[model samples]
Target: MFTIQQIDGAHAKVKTGADFPKYIQEIKELGVTAFDFLVSNGVEVYYGEEPFKTNSPAKYDPLNINENLNAQQFAKELKEHQDGKTDFPYFVKMCAINGIASWKVDLEEYTCTYFDLEGEEVLQEEIPGE
Candidate 1:
């Protein structure tokens, strides 16, 4: 299992979405199999093998998740962020505006799925390897 400190150290290196693959690879190496991140407040629950799990407190103040699902705008912002044109905070604000409630990363599957406020998957993308 991974500690919050270790995860935080790994996460601190992520300045933008372009840095995500490296951060994911680092934490996955630390035994994090999966993690769900709440977009509203930055809370994250990390899972390891069976019976091993941990979580981190919210890193920021809560943001109201929009009810309308603006997939097109979200995709556009996501692409820009992924291209290294936006910082993490900016990307998160974009997510809130576009109605993303949370996101889950499956390290084994190399995928990240975003969900709406209703818990429906809005987008699922392959996570690029470092």
Candidate 2:
């Protein structure tokens, strides 16, 4: 799962040294890999990974960003992962219920949904790291 909360810290750190697009790309890569590891180990995961477009005064070129490709592609690719293999979010939640930290998940795919163990739906406002 991807938490805007946790990512906020990482994002802030990345922004100081990297362009917004590069920072987002790196975060998505790391976040997906972390989720995959947790899934493989049977651990439940929960987080959001939706990508967004913004005008960054911090960037050297305000128009250099492309939201059409990055955010949409990431979301689409992740959905493809869950299409037939296994329910990514469910897999993570199961691990969490058992107190596991990771499970085997298909690294070939990625998504923005999070795993929930308590059977309670998580809202953007409810993420723990925030």
Q: Candidate 2, residues 76-106: lDDT per residue as tens digits?
A: 4334433434344443333344333222222
TM-score of each: 0.98, 0.21
Candidate that would win on TM-score: 1
How far is 130's C-alpha from truth in model 2 (Å)? 29
Query: Candidates' lDDT values, in order?
Result: 0.95, 0.34
Quote the lDDT for 99 in model 2.
Answer: 35
Residues 13-69, candidate 1, lDDT per residue (tens digit)? 999889999999999999999999999999999999998999899999999999999
* Candidate 1 root-mean-square deviation in Å: 0.8
Error of 2 at 114 (Å): 26
- The ten-residue window of minimal lDDT in model 1 covers 121-130
Error in Å for residue 102 of model 1: 0.2
Q: Could you tell me how far off, in angstroms, the CA of residue 39 lies in candidate 2 after the best superposition?
A: 34
Q: Report the Cα lDDT for residue 79, model 2.
A: 42
User: What is candidate 1's TM-score against the reference?
Assistant: 0.98
- What TM-score does structure 2 among the candidates reach? 0.21
